[model samples]
Target: MWSDHAPLTIQLTSPLHKPKTMTWRLHENLLSNPQVAQDIQQALTNYFAENLPQDTSPLLTWEAHKCVIRGILISHSSALKKAQEHTIRELTAKIGTLTQAHKRTLDDTLLRELTAAREELARVLRQS
Candidate 1:
């Protein structure tokens, strides 16, 4: 039972056996914008601090960071979209009002021109 050609029974399961993982940290620039930075920090502290898994594996950490970034982008995009929509509505209303005024003025001018032409034709007919 103790053959010289037998394989080793030990199995590797330590961190050393695994490949070096990418470790990431928040950059200093995250603090550059005071207001946004504060919001990010607060959210990070509350969510990342409290909600992250205890494992902290490289893949999980990377995914968590991506989720946070995605959330921030979504929030910013939503706010920007609202502002754009509001500006569009205001411009559309102003344009409509101007167009209506132009149409009315144009109608009045056409009416005056037609009336003058009719008067000229009546005088010509009476002279003949």
Candidate 2:
């Protein structure tokens, strides 16, 4: 085993690497769940399309969140309900304007939107 001709295996490590995880086995008898899948795919595509940086690598990647929105979108969260009834449609329409906005302006506007959305979500979460 120590001979020069022997093959070697090496493990790679990264200081920032997190452990792998397992999630819900959603496919279990959910073969007919195409609507749920379509909703998630549409939301994910919208998120990526809207948020991807123009020319450089993005600071955040969708994979980093591991599709957390799937649970959020499906849950009976008051935040989701309230947002749909309140600002969501307006925000969605505003997305098209980002193309003409300056980067700094976009950043500030988006951060404000994110904070508002988060507060609403947190309020609903606390209630439940």
Candidate 3:
């Protein structure tokens, strides 16, 4: 009974539960890319050509088609994101180098190049 520390107790009033459902969505920007559009179009055509003659239910075929298209979109979107991130990193480095050069020379040409690079970086960032 000589302990100086106080005892602590914790209690939960209700049981915690995790959400049971997840929603999947396509990135609309991916659709705007011509290569992605062509790939999806080709996938849909192939899917129907191979499966349309089957006796499977229409609902099942539709669901399966959705899964196929989702895979394509996800892959293409991830690749595009990677490329954009690479471009962003390159632009950032170029800007940093140009800033250092401009600081030393104060040349108009370097200033213009730096400005252009900054604008390009901003455009890429906005797309991402």
Residue ranges of candidate 2 with Cα displaced over 4 Å: 1-27, 55-59, 72-128
Which parts of model 3 have CA positions greater than 4 angstroms off?
1-23, 53-55
TM-score for candidate 1: 0.44
Task: Find the candidate with the highest TM-score and give its number.
Answer: 3
TM-score ranking from best candidate downward: 3, 1, 2
lDDT (Cα atoms) of all candidates against the true structure = 0.62, 0.56, 0.92
Q: List the residue pairs that clash in candidate 1.
A: none
Selected candidate, larger TM-score, 1 vs 3: 3
**CA displacement after TM-score superposition, residue 64 of candidate 3 (Å):** 0.8
Query: How many steric overlaps are in each model, in order?
Result: 0, 0, 0
**Per-residue accuracy of model 2 over 11-119 as CA lDDT, tens digit each:** 9999999998965444332324565567667777877776666733565555533555646344524444576555545544454354335354667766666566556
Per lDDT, the best of the predicted structures is 3
> What would the per-residue lDDT of candidate 3 be over residues 44-95, giving only the tens digit for each residue?
9999988884678889999999999999998997898899999999999999
* lDDT at position 23, candidate 1: 53
